[model samples]
Target: LSTVIDGDRRMFAVTDFAGADGSAGLACDTSAAETIRAEHERTVRSHADTLDQLNTAVAIFDTDEKLRFFNQAFQKLWGLDSGFLLSAPSNTLLLDRLRSEGRIAEQPEWRRWKENLLSAYRAVESQEHWWHLPDGKTIRVVANPQPKGGVTWVFENLTEKMDLESRYQTAVRVQGETLDNLAEGVVVFGPDGRLRLSNPAFVALWGLTAEALKPNVHVSAIRDLCDQHAANSPWGGFVAAVTGFDDERRDRRGQIELINGNVLSYAVIHLPNGQVMITFVDVTDTVNVERALKDRNEALEKSDQLKNEFVQHVSYELRSPLTNIIGFTELLSLPATGPLTPKQREYVEYVGSSSSVLLTIVNDILDLATVDAGIMQLDISEMNIDRTIAAAAELVADRLDEHRIKLAIDATEAPASFHGDETRIRQILYNLLSNAANYAPEASTIRLTCRRLADAVEFSVHDDGPGMPPDVLESVFRRFEPRANGGRRRGAGLGLSIVKSFVELHGGTVRIETGQDRGTTVICTFPDKPSGIPDTPAGIRDAAE
Candidate 1:
């Protein structure tokens, strides 16, 4: 509506007029501008939210090097002031602030480092750098060049992840070292019948080139090399085991006499996931020792039996009182016995443990004496290998748990049944496990491996503990030579000695492989049928030599 005034405030008829583009034109343009502004705001807010959600710090700069945007994490990561950040400083200015705040380490040449880092501005792809800060932080920086004249910088903290990877690598190194120090030659074959891993012992024993031992080398090539060392080599059998030629696919073992007059006892282990492992050890000394002692020792032991019986009878008489002492100690340990002081209880515990150890040594001594007297005979039967191992592991479970140790049993390749004296076998397994548990580090695993061969049963106890030195390894199987070496406790060192005596009595073999940084492994091999080798007590003099 419009009003027209005549000469002097005179009223005319009201009328409405509009141009070609009226209020609608201005309103439409304003509405379109408002919608575009709102969309842009939403996009920026979404991008900002994403940046804020990330654990890494991120920032973007324009082509002119002026800071356009940075997330909250960016400010927090650099410990920068919000007021200074809001001023839209340049990249150089921000770096200057970081340097002044002692956030980054001092560069040998600041100008060159800054220039080299900034060269990513002209690069087409992403560039990365590691920043070691003075505050002990390690930042992995990635500079991604944007299509339109700018860079998006991402700063990630890899401190914890790197630390974990370092520890894992250390464990792996220890494992590799352990393998290298083994007395037995171990070679693992993948499903493809190619060598996957071999230890230094394998290389040295077979005269193989350590530098040339690599993955994916075919078994035939290895067989060809090994055949050169033997008169009638079992290389063909080894090839068959690797290729799964025998339909039965069971593990096998046998003795191979080398052309140089050396005898190596070998076992082929069928591993899970279509893998195979073969181990070899030179058993010439053990065979020679058995042969040398066989007839002479039998006659000597018969003569010594009466004297041994007298010693054992006294030992048996002493066992009863020792048992009573242990039982009474247990009774006194109970709270109902008395309200003892903490120190007193502790002293009692020490006494109890010491007495128990002494009693165990006495019992071991008595048992050996009985064997020496030819009064005990091994009752061989079909033994459940898995059950026996579980039983032994259970016996040591409390001690293992006390030390925060882990146990991993690998009997996947073991036979279901083995022929041996069940009690004695359990005792052997128990002693091995107890020794391993004592030495294994906190949170480390003790692995028990039982492998069955065509004619024998093999047991191996492995521990990821601070290993024995060469001298310790030499003396470990000697009676009364135990040094705790940071284990749970010190013993009379009769554990390995007993293991040796029992193993030899079964007409089998026992060998130890150990080193300082590597770890230790004790392996025992028993034939399927008892050799019926007569037993005689190996004297302390034998251990000394």
Candidate 2:
């Protein structure tokens, strides 16, 4: 008898068991079909994930150039909607756009794609080309040969990359040109102690060029000299001598004696980097100037010593004779030397006057010598501007009356507070007022004005006399210069120079304005006192030069 087995769990079955009995029979193959369906779904999901992550567009095309599978990247790259089906027409759409633009550079080496499309498969390696997208973006395209008899293209946007490269090249070229054109020798070495680069000046200095500069020569060659002079240290020890590293900018300078008897000044700079850049400036001219200056200074020192001896000898010689002359003149003026005749009295008076003038000249010369020797010191103090001006004006009041000049004071409404040496300020004002009185024409109006400015007070002496010419304006403050006072009188010209020096010492300025038709004005401006300084007229400062 033959038996039937269930196929779902059957390990063995009897031969000729094809009977479809109701109790025992084979089941359908539903489990196998479900397994195969599950595998197909998993494969599709993996492919979709891979296509989504990629940056470049991917497409699988058929032999006829009809796109079979297009990823999302392809849609974004080509500005196409997902619903559009890719075909030969879509491929031709891109090609047609490229043809209309004709952007590819024209050259004899350039190949036409349409004419040799079929032969592309024979190419050994992938080919690259450039594309200018409609949106004004540049792309570098690479065509990869596919085993399936078609090509896969990938593009990398090269706009930013190309621009950066071009800029880098331009910057390097400019740096090279600037260094090469310089007269000073320049050498840049890498941290590894090799001659990385040098300028034309460096080559000229060393009698070498790019082809001649070998790798072995470096700062180490001068190690002995560097040790002797800290400044000459290859590592720039001299920078510490001149400036503190805590400061922002540091400069290191030293001199180098070359083998050929030439001396050079080397300036070594330490960059923020570990590398050091050294510049050699041929300071031959500077060295020569320094030697000359030294010689001149020695000569000046000797001359000053001689001047001191001469001053001492002259002072001794003049003092004894001056005392005798003054005593005799006074005795004669007193009518005690046996009642002198009228002519003798007049002669005695003239002698006295001449002697007094000579004394004044000697005093002026001594004062100038003291100033030149720096023996005169400034006595700073608070000064009332109006009081000083009044005192100075009083000294010249008699002269003003004698000349019949009109004198006007414009200080009643202005502030009179300032910080300066009282005596110096008075001297300055006295000199300026006296100069005006002497230079102005008879009966000319002299206006003395004082006013407060933003940070200083201005004192002015204005005259209605002839103004200065342009040529005289430039050197008016020079010592011993005479003014063209209507071609009438000449002055010693030292007054203005003294005024200028005194005013500048007190952190002030003096100015002169002169012209032919318009009269001359001498203005002196002084720094004002801070808010709470008291106003008081003090004693005058000692007069120097």
Candidate 3:
């Protein structure tokens, strides 16, 4: 007996044992047959479970074009429910789905498959097929022959892969657009010195088109710029060295002048991917400002030389005539040289006095002119600080007496020897002492102190006079800035300003301190002498020579 089942139906075959036996009795072994039937049922159940767990859809079609079996995946792919059996002749939708999904091209592969299916061939294979699922997805498919008179097919969807590739292509296009639109001139060079890529600005700067920029462009072609400008040659060297280093990344910065007189500064960065990007910026304004400043400095120096020449010439020219005039006036003033009436004697005395005043004015004018011209050269020498202060004190002694000012000099612990311009040093002290005596009130005390500090010597003049206002104290050294109601009570403002300039020229500084009731104090510091120099009493005179 034989039994068969197709999905939902069953078939059975029974044998009559008595017909096959000749004079043999038949016995029914119900228990043994029942055990055999039970084993068979268990085997079939296990197979059905295995097929249900499969990921891919499996289907079978008989030679008669009737669908016999279909797996879970196959039914889901076709959007079909159970109880639906498909036949090759009745199901035009299957063919339509294959054609629309581009699985069966109207070419050799599809044509051959179609011929086999229409002829009801027992078994056939489909070459690289595809199908369109109900959900509008494309699935690559292939139908293979089975041992039984049927065909088994398998397919997988490829929608996500195609989408990813399409997006990738779009991203590349956008990146290219961004590079081209950049403002900086960018030129990329490949590893072999070929032009791999360049932005629009770069092309315009080099006076070349995209077609002209190629890897074959020689390094020598760009090296000529080095020989053209010596100062700018280092920039070219930087470019060549960085490019030839074969490094992952390198940078070079340089300057170049364009045909239109514009200066261009560029920075080039080399990337590991055989590319170099160069950016350029205009620097014409900076270059022009520096050049103009250099030219102006030269012009000022020349102008200063001319002014000094004029002052020296004038001083020499006037000195000779003044000497003679003063000598004649002195002779007339001498009583023994000539006897004269009272009126004549008075006139001669007047002429002598006027001549003396004129001589002093001329000398003062010459001294100031020389100082302004920077020709008042200092003669560095050694001198006694105490003696220098005494001489300065004597020079201003009469003024001090006239004002009834108490003049005190404190040089008890000053340096015994120093190297500097003695005459200029004395001049500075005399000016300070004289200014203090003249500007302070009649009963005020003027103090002059000199002391040796760590690295230098300090000289200060302190006066207990009506002090300068806060505003005037700060600018006391500025030329011609009058103090105490426009300096009506003192000498012209040039004296202190001149003192400051000459002191600074000797590498020293001056400062003033004052308040409403507190008197003004002026301090000047001079650098100390080194131990190598010898001390001499005649040091001051020798320095003057």
Candidate 4:
């Protein structure tokens, strides 16, 4: 049969059939058949339009493995030209083109992979595959076989999603390992008041087993276990913090003393996700050390007070008897007192000198005690530098003469006068000179150099004698640590100590320069006007050269 539709001629085959009554019949229903064929074509077009609108790249291949249809996304995903996609390339040819373009990773068994992918055409169920493209794109491919003997391929870009999953897994693993190795006990509770996370330290600190601290255990159940270990448990607060509906959600920190004598410092932190994290650190040793230090400090203060008082009493007691002895010795040497033989006279002189030295030692002890008590006050005043030097030189003149040591005065650079406590300056110079005399070699010259600097006056006493060794020089200014150290005689070791104390009182510094075989020099620098603030002495140096 032939018909005309839309200006085009269509032809259909007619069939002749016989009926049950032996009659001949002919059938030609071309119009109804054309209508059904047109409807089916429209339905296929509608499905193709829907697939084109999807983000997933879709392609359809026929039983011949030739590409029949593809969406815009498929062209964009592979970066292929539209002309090439419309050329009806076979599935294997398409894969080969993509591989040659380096859009997909190279396959070691290319033929095998291709054969396996093509197997989806005969598969009863959908086949899934993962393709990691060379451009770092991950594509999830699903091949769904159609009832009419073709496959519909879906390509989903899952690179970002898979990357996010991988990073999340790594973060969780790192956090778990970090929490496990921490020294502090840590526990986290969910908003539902159930234990969500905890470390081994938390379990050990609470004296609980791993089973007792298992995930999903209620806070109240953990609280009961904590109460047995601690006199006052902090878990009660933790439970409220985790489950309570307070809007503020303030964090808290406190200390708890356990029945076993351990002290734990704890902090309650509220996370943004409605979880509570509690951390505990043991501070038992730290607390004990603080208490012991406080007690020792108090005892030391009391002992220092007793020592000051005892030193003052003993100094006064010895001073009175020493004054009487010195006075009687002088009286015995007087002409009115019975005339003494030369031996007797020498003995009296010795007694007087010995008493004087003892009195000086007692006075030094008293002065040091006053300094230790922090009550030593300087009498600040202006004094003639030349007169002070003269007086100190006179005081040590006898000793220098006995040692056959000559004093060299060099005050060419010294100021005429400076503001200072006249008595203390005199004492400072006297101590320096006396110390020099004690160590000066027989017939050796001791140099006394004084200079006026821009901001201070400097005084130095250098002795030409066997110098101190490293060991003796280390403690040269320490009180009561007397070492003969090649000196004519060992002193009470107060001369240098007194010098340091008095010079520092004027806000000055003391420095000793000495070494074995080399002579010793003691330098004292006084501020032009007292700074009124004492400082630690400057360092000692080895003056071997």
Look at candidate 2 and tell me the lDDT of residue 31. 51
Over 4 Å off, model 4: 1-57, 62-64, 68-84, 95-116, 119-126, 131-138, 145-150, 157-164, 190-194, 218-224, 232-255, 267-276, 289-304, 531-545
Q: What would the per-residue lDDT of candidate 3 be over residues 175-237, giving only the tens digit for each residue?
A: 678878765676566666655666676665545556555555644444453334333444455
Model 4, 1-545: lDDT tens per residue?
Answer: 77776897765667767778786656454776787889999999999999999989999999998999999889889999988888999999999999999998999999998999999999989999999998999999999999999998999999999999999999999999999999899999888889889998888887899988888999899998899998788878888888999999999999999999999999999997898999999999999999899999889767767766887799999999999999999999999998999999999999999999999999988887767656788888889999999999999898888868899999999999998988988888888888878778889999999999999999999998788888888788877777787787888878888888788778888899988878899999999987675633342111110
* TM-scores vs. true structure, each candidate: 0.45, 0.64, 0.53, 0.77
Question: Can you tell me which runs of candidate 3 are displaced by over 4 Å?
Answer: 1-186, 196-253, 267-277, 325-333, 337-381, 415-419, 464-486, 489-494, 497-507, 514-519, 530-545
- Cα-based lDDT for every prediction: 0.83, 0.66, 0.64, 0.87
Where is the poorest 10-residue window by lDDT in model 1?
Answer: 23-32
Superposition TM-score, candidate 1 onto the true structure? 0.45
**Candidate 1 lDDT tens digits, 300-417:** 7666666556656887887888888888888888988988888988887887887787787888877666565566677878889998988988998988898888889999889898
Q: Residue 483 lDDT in model 1?
A: 74
RMSD of each: 27.5, 8.0, 13.2, 7.8
lDDT per residue for candidate 2 within 390-489, as digits (tens), equals 8998988977998898889898666757777788788888877877887778888899998888888888998877788888887777655677656345
Candidate 2's C-alpha runs over 4 A off are 1-41, 63-65, 76-84, 87-116, 119-151, 155-167, 212-276, 280-316, 338-346, 374-437, 443-464, 467-478, 482-484, 487-545
User: Residue 8 in candidate 2 has what lDDT?
Assistant: 49
